[model samples]
Target: MSPAVDVQHIAKAFGQFQAVREATFEVRFGEIFALLGPNGAGKSTTIRMILDIIRPDSGTIRVFGRPLDDAAKNQIGYLPEERGLYKSQKVLDMMTYLGTLKGLKPAESRKRAMSYLERLELADFAKKKVSDLSKGMQQKVQFAVTVMHEPRLLIIDEPFSGLDPVNRMVVKEWLYELRQKGSAIVMSTHQMNQVEEMADRLLMISRGQQRLYGEVQAIREQYAIHAIIVEGQGDWSRLDGVTQVESLNEQRRGAVRLHLRPEVSYDDVLAAIARDDSLTIERFERAVPSLDDIFIQVAEEDAQEVRWLNRREAEREVEKEAV
Candidate 1:
């Protein structure tokens, strides 16, 4: 089957500010595709273009192998970063109304709305006004409404906003279930840990430019440092081929991170540790950088490049004035 969303070289700008620059990617069925970027990095603009909320300045977007139209729009469900609901309306009533707007009959919409409320542990709040619910509860109600119609493609921004850990897991499980049922999910969030746990593939944008795009694990491996994390009692700094050793705990008694020389393989380091009788080895493995680490690294790199470009431009203007 064709991907649920295919965006090719799409660019959008507001006045003189370019919000998205030649962004391109695909969201396939039965998978969670993460849209990652820092604030004002054009993620919202790109999503708007895909939803046809705003027309792109250039490039093409195909929803399910065809240009996005009324039918295509119906197949997409969007949960924006900002919540929108009738605050004065009761929870169940508002949800049911939203469901009908998505094409379900009144009875079916009400049934599904009630079922979702119960599943999300908000059944008791059915009669409560939307404004009376807590922020997290309101968030759940919005999510329930978004998926009640079971759109083929779901675009959710910060889906776990205001949610505690327990509720967060509930939403995560729901997304997994949707993916298993062949719904293409596009999640945009700043939570790197959640992204690492849930996303199959990701597209990261920096300064409105596509910085990284690939399978989550592949991208992590690409940014992996040549280091090992050892959890045991040992003088890791004494090990041969270990360039540096840093404590991974506050007490300095739990795990130590060993930075290895490029030429030394993991096996070689393991052998060295084994040879030292004083060292007690409990857990040893390669130290993989987390998504948070990668995100900061990429953002810092981009910022540094921008500063350099600004400096070059300033120098050019100075030279022109002198001439």
Candidate 2:
């Protein structure tokens, strides 16, 4: 089957500055795909172009085997970076109106709107004006509107920006539920932890270029540290390539975080440590790079590339002016 969304060789610019450069990726059906990058990395521009909010200067976007069209648009839902609501409008009325715009009728919209409100614990605030709700409450209301139409593809940008931890969890759970129901989600966020927890796959972009895109677990494995943490009794201090060994707690128990030598095997480490029969083993597990580390490494590498490009551009400018 075709991907739920696909962007190939997409590029966009504003006047003289390119916002996105040859960005490309695909979002599989029924999976949560995350776009992670720092600010000004062309995330918003790429998203806008994909949604047809802004036409790409060059490239193609396909949704479900067809180009972006009214049918595709109707099948997708979007929650933007900036939240907006009619301050004077009742929560239910506002959401119902937005839902209606998606082709839902008054009765159907109200039914789904109330169901979402109840599920989000916002049922009590149905009659209240948007302005009366707290920031988090308002966010939930906006979320309700985003899903009221039951779109197959959901694109949410910074969905957790203003949410408190409690509400954040609420939203997170709802997103997972949507994925289980076969919704294709393309979300952009700075919260690496959330991406790690929720995203099945991710695309990392910098300066509108794709830096990394793959299954989350596979990417983590690609950058995996071939190391292990041993929590047991052994004089690991003398172990070779063991970069750091710190005490866990009492003298009888300690943990060693090892950075193995290229030729050494984990089995060798365990065998050496097990020599001391008196030493008790507590925990032994391989160390893997966290999502934060991967994100930082990718972003830092991209920043370095951008700096190099800027320097090259500067040199070209000076050479031209010299002539």
Candidate 3:
């Protein structure tokens, strides 16, 4: 089957600067895909193009095997980086109104909106004016409006922003529930830990280009460092392939992070430790770099691309002056 959403070689430019360049990827059904990048990485611009809020200068976007259009719009739900709602309107009324725009009738919208509000613990605040609610409360209402119509695809940009830890957990759980119901979701967020927690796959872009896009585990494996922590009295420094080792604790009771020579074998290292009768193995495990580490690695890789481009531009300018 075709993917839930697919964009092939999409490019968007503004004047002399390209905001997105040859970006290509797809979101599989029933998986949470994350778009991760720093500010000005064209994440929002790319999302807008996907939603047809802004047409791409070049390339195609297909939703459910059909080209993007009005009918396809109803198949996708979008929660933008910026929140939009009528401040003076009653909470339930505003939510229902927005839902109605997505093809839900007023009665059906109200029923769905109220059900969500009550589940979100905002039923008592249903009649209250949106302006009277706190920022967090309004955010929850916005979330309600976005999902009430039950689109097959959800595009959420920074869904965890401005949410407290408790509320963040609530929203995270709700997102998983949506996925459990077979909705494909693409979430854009800077919170690496949260992305690692929820995303099944990741598409990282930097400076208008794709840096890394693949299964999260695969991406992590690609950047794995050959290092491990050994928690014992063993003098890891004497082991073959041991590049360096520092006492992890002043009391000599903590694990050490060993930097290994690329050619060293795990068996050789273990053999060395085994010879140390005084050493008692408390824990021995390979070091697995976290998502944050992977993010930094990929971002740096993209930054180098940007630097190379800048150098070529500078050289062209110098050649022009010589001419």
- In order of listing, the candidates' clash counts read 0, 0, 0
Clash pairs, candidate 3, are none
Best by lDDT: 1
Q: Which regions of candidate 1 deviate over 4 angstroms?
A: 246-254
Report the C-alpha lDDT of model 3 over 192-230, residue by residue, as the tens digit: 888878899999998888888999888877877787778
Q: Which 10 consecutive positions of candidate 1 have the poorest summed lDDT?
A: 246-255
Of models 1 and 2, which has the larger TM-score? 1
lDDT of 1 at 92: 89
In candidate 2, stretches whose alpha carbon ends up further than 4 angstroms from where it belongs are 230-237, 240-256, 277-282, 309-323
Better of 2 and 3 by TM-score: 3
Clashing pairs in 2: none
lDDT of 2 by residue, 1-323 (tens): 89999899999999988888877889988899999887888999988888889999898998887888887887888999998899999999988898888989999998899889999888999999999999889988888888888788999999899999889889888888889999899999998888888999999887777888999989998988778877866567677567666544535546666778777788887787677565567888776777888988988887788799999999999999999
Residue pairs that clash (backbone atoms under 3 angstroms), model 1: none
Model 2, global lDDT:
0.86
- Residue 72's lDDT in candidate 2: 83
lDDT of 1 by residue, 102-191 (tens): 889999999999999999988999999999999888888988888899999999998898899999889999999999999999999999
Stretches > 4 Å off in candidate 3: 231-235, 246-256, 277-283, 308-323
